[model samples]
Target: MDKLEEITSDGVAVCQPGLRLGQLESEARKKGWELRMYPSTLVKASVGGFLAGGSGGIGSVAHGGLRDFDTVRAFEVVTMEKKPRVVLHEGPAVHEILHAWGTNGILTRIWFALTPAVEWMQLTAAFSTYEEAFQFAESIATGNTWTKRLATVFEWPIPSFFTPIKRLVRADKSLVLIMIAASQADALHAAAIAAGGEVTFTGAFDGPRTQPLLSDYTWNHTTLWAMKADPAYTYLQCGFSLTECREQFRKLRERYGQEILFHIEFMKNGDGVVIPGAIPLVRFSTEERLNDMIAFCRSIGVFVANPHVNYLEDGGRFRPDNIQLLAKQRYDPRGLLNPGKMISFRKQVVTK
Candidate 1:
């Protein structure tokens, strides 16, 4: 909100912090604009980081990922005019100002649209077998069975390891199924159970009423602990329908075998590209699961854009875009203002 207020006031210049809430994006989408935040808006990442480095979190799945949401209106840029070279540009010429690899101009502020916020509710079901749990996960996420939010389901290869808390889950074959509902808990609940799941509602009132899943969202920690085999492990983001996801998912499970621990978080995909972490960050022992996540991602072609893979590798910083951006470092031919990062990138640079 600070960044939003800043840009609106024309004083503050940038943003992107934590997991972006769908309610916020949906609200923005109504006006024909959306912003994809990395690590999330909740963490409050700077928009400069978001624009400079393509990153995303909870709000990505439905918001067309990152670049898709930004349709910049005008630029308050420095043009070459005697001592002050700032130009207000129109049309594709704005490209000279944007994606400049960080040199052509300093992006102080921008004017964009807002989207509608998606109201959501989360649901879960625990089963006794991987097939049962994965089946329901696949089933619910199949045809947009639920609106606004996606079903996040996981299977415990060793259900007994979870114990009484784990026992609440079946025994050796239990599967934990989770889904999100817009408002109809009863209807969504019934649908999940009917499709072969043992359902449970995770959240309960501790204070006053707030919109359910949409109000306070969480979905990543679950995947991290359960999917990331080791604490040192990392993960990546990808887009695939239930069918495509499952096909590749099976291939991953079978090919990697025990070497890789795999799990998936499901989220609704419409216009935005999101990273859906389990509601409310919860940490369970995920060390063993993470070790294989990185390798698994490469196997599947999922791009993991954390600080490691992209940054830190250019000549020294290991960023090539910085090198390209160096040519257009100045809005004016003679460099005056502080220029952007001058380095290189190791990964591929994509244009929108």
Candidate 2:
């Protein structure tokens, strides 16, 4: 809660890691500045958690994730050694603990890159089918005339989970959730109409809202909504390159059918190319079936970032990260902090 630093005119803000992201954002908003990237759970997520956990959320389409290096300018960590020392890592060196799940070091403070704040409006467009919604989301995500903070498509019937805003969603229509610059509303509306969608809802976050914020319905929140409506569900995290999106999407739908509800969030890659990433709300069966589904998705060239596991590597790349390994060795030599999260650290000790 302390260390609320001043936001630079250029949009950089340095503060204590304990500060909530939502509070920081509100402070910066007064100065017309905003964090370049933030997860949807901003109100509850801390600056430290976002970095140490390696999170990506709303602004990732433009700013990438916390691991992007530029997103985080610096990290001040307290080592977990017998003689603990304060270490300040700059630039890419911060990556050592950036997503180490707090296994490598304790983050005490962080410096984040910020951007000019915009009056963002939450808008939802309805389409006749999930396919049209997907195509329309991609177009707006990659469009030049209108910039967006978020673009997510939900398959038909999934919108029913938003019981708070049941009137906004139609039973027969799929939903496209978006957050765009208020100035570009007309352009976005035109694009949606041209793409065979109806702009159903549009308003600011504070503008007479009866339901939760639009972002709370997108991202992993979509999965939460589904789980609320039907407790018999889990979710998967997978990325589909533009080239493989249509084919893989169709194949998965055909294979899982109603058992898997398709939801996709459009994001730009490291190179700023648009791609559709899926978080399929899966009807729970057994662990074996989940593993089989992950394997099947990967076999079809879909990159599955497994969410069912707890280990950092298992949840992500499924292999040891060299940078994280080096950081743990230097900062948490005794491995007293957040044990059992880094698979590589355990293996290193066994080998020794």
Per TM-score, the best of the predicted structures is: 2
lDDT string for model 2 (145-253, tens) is 6678888989888999988878669888999998888888888888889999988888875421225588778788888888999999889998987987889887887
Cα deviation in Å at residue 6, candidate 1?
9.0
Q: For model 2, which pairs clash?
A: none
Best by lDDT: 2
Off by over 4 Å in 2: 206-212, 317-321, 347-352
**Compared with the true structure, what per-residue lDDT tens digits does model 1 show for residues 1-352?**
3244323332222333222333334334344333333232333334443443433344343443333445444445644324555555444444444433344455544544334333445555676565667666655554444443344544454333333244245544444434343566677677667867677554432111332331122234443444344453333344434445556656766755644334445544434323322221112335444435545654675533332233223312223444334334444344332333433312223232
Clashes of each: 88, 0
